[model samples]
Target chain A: AQTVTQSQPEMSVQEAETVTLSCTYDTSESDYYLFWYKQPPSRQMILVIRQEAYKQQNATENRFSVNFQKAAKSFSLKISDSQLGDAAMYFCAYRSGIGGSNFGNEKLTFGTGTRLTIIP
Target chain B: EPEVTQTPSHQVTQMGQEVILRCVPISNHLYFYWYRQILGQKVEFLVSFYNNEISEKSEIFDDQFSVERPDGSNFTLKIRSTKLEDSAMYFCASKGGAGRNQPQHFGDGTRLSIL
Candidate 1:
């Protein structure tokens, strides 16, 4: 069984600043993927960024990036130049590689979520 | 860009009533999935469907939850009996059927409100 944990229940960042949301996961599998998803007030789940366990270098998407430390089992999301629109709940998820099984490969185990707030 | 679409942006139903949430996956997608997010909570995986059969489902998707691909385009989630706990935003997702990110495309979601 795999589990993800986001210790921060809530975090606030000033407009145009940066904030890093922490995440930790437990999985015995070697090949896997990590993802950060953001859900706004509209309740729409949006993919922020993703990182593969095999890739030592973290993943970056525009202003969103991930600090993935495979050995430490830690994957954190960093949002730079945060805007008001970034205010939402952010989740950390994990998925196994392909050829596994249905709930096998792509099934995502999500963390509790961190409510991100951007203050102007 | 091709994306998933879900119907009934918002649904109001009473407890014990049956409700079906509809989704139209991308034309080329072969993998479909259903997830839900309760108010102020993380998104939870409900079920996954592929090759016209249920590939996987979570413990939360018990007897009350069912999924069907009635046709080439529509994938639906039917709840036998709605409950207050069932109130949440139901999301439909699809992927290209290959790759690592497999980047699941998500629909805006159908807000299910059980009264």
Candidate 2:
């Protein structure tokens, strides 16, 4: 079983600044996928970015980037030039990448989530 | 951009009653899933469906819970006998069949309130 952990319960960043949310996971499987999801006041779970365990280079999507350390089992999200819109609950999620009987049916395991607040 | 859409943004049912939450996944998606999140808690996977049958399910998904793709477009999750603890936000997600690693797109979830 894979478990995701987000140690930070709450985080705040000043507008236009940068912020990093930490996440770690314990998985015996070598192949897997990591993702960051954002939930705003609307309560919609939106995918922010994703990283593959095999990729040595981190994944970057505009202002959102990830620091993935496979050896350490750590995957963190960094938001640059943060804006008020970034204020939301962020969750770290994990999914198996192995292909077998459960090929496309792999379920996502999620962390407790970190509340991000952008201060003006 | 194709999106998964869930119906009845909110549902209120009495304990021990049956409740069904519906979702319309992306037209081209081949994988469907149901997940739930209690207020102030992390999202938890319930079940995953593929090829019209359930391929995976979690411990939280007990006998009281069922999933069906009754038609070409609708995917439904039914709780046979709801309990107060079942009250949570139910989310529907779908993924394209092109590859196994494709990200799953999620719907805006239905808030299920069991009284």
Candidate 3:
């Protein structure tokens, strides 16, 4: 079984600054996918960015980027130029790859979320 | 962009009563899933449906829980007998075909309150 861990329960960043949220996972499988989801007060789960385990280069989406260290089993999210809209609960999620035992059924395993607050 | 939509943004039901949450996934999506998150907790996967049958389920998904895609576009999750502990935000998600690196798209969850 794969387990995701977000050590920080709460984080705050000043407006226009950068913030990094840490996440680690334990998985025996070699191929997998990692994702970051944001949940605002509206409670909608919005995709922030994703990283493929096989890719050595990190994934970047505008202001949101990921630092994926496969050997260390760590995937972290970095938000640059943070804005008030970035204030939300962020979750790190994991999913098995195509060849894994649970191939056809790729359900996501999520970590305890970290509530991000943007200070003006 | 295509999106998954769930109905009755909020539901309140008595314990021991049946409750059904409905969702309309993206028109082209082939995989459907149900997940729940207790207040202040992480989102947990419940079940995944493909080809009109359940392909995977979690320990949390017991006999009391059921999923069905009764029609062409609607997917539903039913709780035969709800319990207080079942109160949580139920989310519906869908994804494209297998072997692709597509991310699962989620809907705005339905808050289920069991009294």
Candidate 4:
């Protein structure tokens, strides 16, 4: 069984500042995928970025980047130059590889969440 | 770029009533999926469909729940008898690049409200 944990229940950042949301997971599989999803008040779950366990390189998408420490089982999201639009509930998720059955593929083990608030 | 789309942005129904949430996946996608998000909770995967059949489903997707791709463009989730707990945002997603390893694209989601 896989489990994801988001220690921070809430986070806030001033405009143009940066904020980091923490996440950790428990998985026996050596290969897997880690993802960060954002759910604004609109209620849509949007993918922020993703990182593969085998790849040592951290994933970065514009203002969103991840500090992935595989050995520590830690994958944290960093939002740089944060904007008010970044205010949302962020979740960390894990998925097993396609070739292997995983616990299940489409099923994502998600961290409770870290509600991000952007202050003007 | 293609995107997944779901129908009835919001659905309000009475308990024990049957409700079906629908989605239209990207034209070239192969794997389809359904996930739900209870208010103020994490998004949960319900089932995954591939090759016209269900490849995997979570324990949450019990007998009361069913999924179908009735025709070419539609994938539907039918909850036989809705419960108060079933009220949540239902999301449909699709992934394909000639393989199952592709990153999934999700729909806006249908807000199911049971009162």
Highest TM-score, which number? Answer: 2
* Per-chain TM-score of candidate 4, chain B: 0.96
DockQ of 4: 0.46
Model 1 pairs whose backbones collide: none
Q: How displaced is residue B25 in candidate 3, in Å?
A: 0.3
Model 1 lDDT per residue over B27-88, tens place: 99988889998977878999888888888889999999999999889999999999999999
Ranking by DockQ: 2, 3, 1, 4
How would you order the candidates by TM-score, starting with the best?
2, 3, 4, 1
Stretches of candidate 3 exceeding 4 Å from the true structure: A99-104
lDDT of 2 by residue, A1-120 (tens): 899999999999999999999999999999899999999988888999999898899999999999999999999999999999999999999999984887977889999999999999
Query: lDDT tens digits, residues B1-115, model 4?
Result: 6889899999999999999999999998878889998987878889988888888889999999999999978999999999999999999988875343457778889999999
- Which CAPRI tier for candidate 4? acceptable
- Computed on C-alphas against the true complex, the DockQ of each candidate is 0.55, 0.75, 0.70, 0.46
Which of the two, 1 or 3, has more lDDT?
3
The C-alpha stretches of model 4 lying farther than 4 A from their native spots are: A98-105, B98-101
TM-score for each model = 0.94, 0.98, 0.98, 0.94
Task: State the TM-score for model 2.
Answer: 0.98
Question: What TM-score does structure 4 among the candidates reach?
Answer: 0.94
lDDT of 3 by residue, B2-108 (tens): 88999999999999999999999999989999999999888999999999888889999999999999997999999999999999999999988785488899999
